[model samples]
Target: MKDRFDYGQNPEKTKGGELIAAYLCDPETADAEFLLSKAKYKAITGREQKKNADILCYQIRQSFLPGEITPEDANRIGYEMGMRWTKGKYAFFVATHIDRHHIHNHIYYNSTALDCTRKFRDFIGSARAVRHLSDRICLENGLSYIAHPKLHSKGKFKHYGEWQDDNRPPTFQERLKAQIDSCLAEKPQSMAAFLQAMVSAGYEVKHGRGGVISFRAEGQKRFTRLRSSTLGKGYGQEDIQAVVEGRAASSEGRGAPPRKVNLIIDIQSRMKAGKGPAYERWAKIFNLKQMAATLQYLQESGLLEYEQLEKRATGAADRFHVLSGQIKSIEGAMSVNAELKAAIMDYAKTRPAFKGYEAAKYSKKYLAEHEAEIALYRAAQATFRHVLSGAKLPKMDALKAEYQKLAAEKRAAYRDYRAVRKDMQEVVTAKANIDHLFGLTDTQKNKEQER
Candidate 1:
């Protein structure tokens, strides 16, 4: 139990212990507290709880999808789940670990009741109950949860990372969309030719009532209707007809924005790996389309000249960095302000207890009775000493005003930061595509700039 607690509260995993939270006990001393509870249980019941027969604590691991939750929120969610599960009867601590790609929480709660008169017993279907409770909490916090979870043959669910690794195969609708995209890329001359092209690509096309076109791939049980409602707007019969007649642009018929231009594959390298003429032809066409898109974007952005495009890309990158630094600075100030505010409130609430202890001349009995309050007061004093040094503490109203001002500044900076980041990304991507198309290496680019 101690080993598990140590592992869960590893400083490296929990951001140097910053992401740890406890309820009813100090997290650092929680193991000792649990041991103390066991001793009390033995004294009350006259039964020494054997290590093998007794459960020391329970650990719940709650994981979040990568990038879906922040570490602080994960810790809070874990703490809330523990409180709900234990009903405030147990002491627990939640340690949020961000050492892996996915953020997860490790909650360890004592098995003995807070009063040390009873022990928690595991019941049937408790695992399912925990899962349902976790799902409910996740949804309440606006996080996604698996609605229909599948169990493995062993009657257990796969690990989160394993589930992510086993990416589901593309659905029938997705496969059909890809086939349609490929057929459209060939620029079929007529609807008849388009249907024929699909047939050649291993699809069975059917002309249904009201001129509705349906298609079924090999081994498919049912034919999928190629209607605006079924296959989305761009794959509708009318849209395809317009594209065939050259009445609408191919991109418009596809019902999606143009894909960003990307670097072309190295055909020579691919051919050395045994690619045939058909593959080479496809690669050449793909490269041609990408170059066309690149040129169009350059024309629209007024960056036809390489020098102007390079300069704009550099300026966009610099602006993005400046905005990012500003947001970080504002966020740091807000964190300090929040911490100080909390300390001030804690100090105020515990002031009466500290004064009574002082009046009692720091009597042992008084100190024992008011231990928690005195500890809180001392913590707040330490915080003030560290944060304010010798300076006078600011008023709560002043701190609140400062925090609000910093938050407003952060919001404004964040908006500009997002805009600058997007601009930087687009400009940088365009510059990279241009370099790849022109076969310009970094050394060559530097030489050209010098020239």
Candidate 2:
């Protein structure tokens, strides 16, 4: 799960930035987790899913509360998070959130520490690497992970890594409202009590106008106006009806749970064996989400056909795959010389490992100097046998020659381009010099001479 949490100051209590910072960053704090963005938050996801979100902050908090602090207490929280994660060493980068709904903590940390240093280490320049770490942290901490390509608002739905902001997940309040409303009826007695009841009943409550409480339950809305008339008048028609209707209106619990969403990666993990509710929740994390749909809607702006989404996704995948394959090939090529050198060194270090039994004391380090060509020779012999036995394909000397020829041609082409560029510069200089001289000479009748 990937998540960003806003640890607030109990609203009625003192708001201290230092305490939150100290708690979150204090290398020794426990029960803490971090999130990279609010993209998949109930605040974000619930809106599109159920029509609204229920988040309160988007920035890091600094107090005794958890998950909302930073550098001010690094070592303490580092050790704390590390111990809970059961990994030695940890590192998390703090971020500032400008969104006011939630004063959240964005955590980017590692699960394991360096074996050599025992201190958490990270590749500071890699966002992808950080995402992996962020995903791991979310799962371990029961947070949600967001996949990239955030969905857009007014477009046909896009898939993973394709959605823009318009199709993003529901906002926090929406989700909160839904969870609160699940199999729940709004209690008009008091807003706070109504919210508390909803929460206890596994619903996330949202306050509406006229003291009305609105929430979503099983994909539908359940709203009721709050009033003191019922209590003061010893229950009116609506109240009498509510008591009679609330029971009749009470819905059967789905008996399942919410799904786990990976907004950043557009992935949903399976529920653990014992976590029934979670399994139900994660089961819903599918290929298509409103965020993606929203993006698709925005992109196409008309009734969508299945083929278009598939086509775009397939093309994008194929292109990325090609790039991935090329990268792998380049990496292999870069390692060739190193591998050849290492093989030669290995042959020298342990000559007996091969057919050659050179019996002389030698330094282990000698392997670094000579094993490559030796391996090549051995390979050639194997190839010769393979050809003789007719059990394997014959070696391609033509291919080798062609490859070397291409390499040489490439080098030559580069040299030629450089030479041509230099010559062009010389020509330009000569022309400039001629112009300077002619200007001093003052040939005023050049127009007629040209004709």
Candidate 3:
């Protein structure tokens, strides 16, 4: 049975309450607010308590396989997952809707904690945590779980959302890549010939210092670099030359499948199926090495046990949020400083016109001739009236210095933010890897339970 889970924050508390009320009104569902206490009033309380919290509520959807789960069972699973994940910190409401062929649960939880001390942080991999918990719950209840093979693959790959939508027109790079591939397929005699063919295809090519080639497709915003890294290695200069001179075949059809991260090797299961004694020995050694590596990682992180690892992970997540808040505060200050500096400079620059108009008032002919100047001066005065509020505009130099100070502060904050963010990612990744290993072990245990 395949299950899908996705969540998004609700910025408006009233709107979130309305959404929950609407879901509860669904005809197929009864006892909509299952396992919830004062669900209707929590949204109001959440808004009253946390005035600055943008994410007042989080809307979560848990969809189950069609006909696999009844509405009652789905509601139970949803409530269990919600309570388990929230840890009684946040108030939540769950509604089961069988409006479609499949049974799905709509859950809305308050962002603020019950004690009004902490807020629910939707940190990195938090969604995956929900999914993992949900899957485990499904396995416990004798229901099948969908395995996401793509997620298990190695490297930073494009997710389902990141993939190019077929409904939209081809991307600039895609079109250019296709054109380049087409040119290469014809087998040009030289690199120049390939360039000529690209030009004939209505592409504007510019060759720069150090063999840097850039192409500007028609109606494209900016020129795209034709470097080996930008395009695939097969479209590089050497590859192009090889194709042109008929020395080498095109590697387009020969691209290898993406390598997977097989850190959690199920060698024992493979050996148990029909492997030899040598394979068993190797598997034993591999498992021992992995266990040692895990222990070393925990030791370095000062986390001796699983509970300590969990606490450390939470601290890392909190640190990331703190760093993010600092960066945002710095950026906001910098923007305000920049805007103030620009306004001050503009007022100062218009002062000369105001002085010129005042001096020219003695000459009636000059006043009539330079009416535009007087109008500009009046406009500047009006702007300064609104901006400075009866006070004189500050000197441009002082405003500039303030802006520079803010800019420097922002830069320093950003540098620190980057370092903290990197550390947070490392901690989060280590936690995720450990969780994945534990998940694999849980799957094995589940299989044993099934047998």
lDDT of each: 0.83, 0.37, 0.62
Lowest lDDT 10-residue stretch of candidate 3:
1-10
Model 1: per-residue Cα lDDT over 1-451, one tens digit each: 7788889999999999999999998888888999999898787546687878779899999999999999999999999999999999899999999999999999899998886756887974588778899999999999987765765534488876555331223457866876887798899988899999999998999888998899998768999998788878677788878878988766435456655655556679889999898667657756666677678778878997999999998899889888888887998888789889989987998899999999999999999877767877898999999999989999999999999999899889977887887778777767876887787758776454322
What's the best-to-worst order under lDDT? 1, 3, 2
Which ranges in model 2 have alpha carbons more than 4 Å from their true place? 1-174, 177-303, 343-451
**Model 1 lDDT on a 0 to 1 scale:** 0.83
Clashing pairs in 3: none
In order of appearance, the predictions have TM-scores of: 0.52, 0.22, 0.32
Instruction: Look at candidate 2 and tell me the lDDT of residue 296.
Output: 40
Candidate 3's C-alpha runs over 4 A off are 1-52, 149-451
Write down the TM-score for model 2: 0.22
Sort by TM-score, top down from the best: 1, 3, 2
For each candidate in turn, give its C-alpha RMSD to the true structure in angstroms. 13.4, 30.3, 22.3
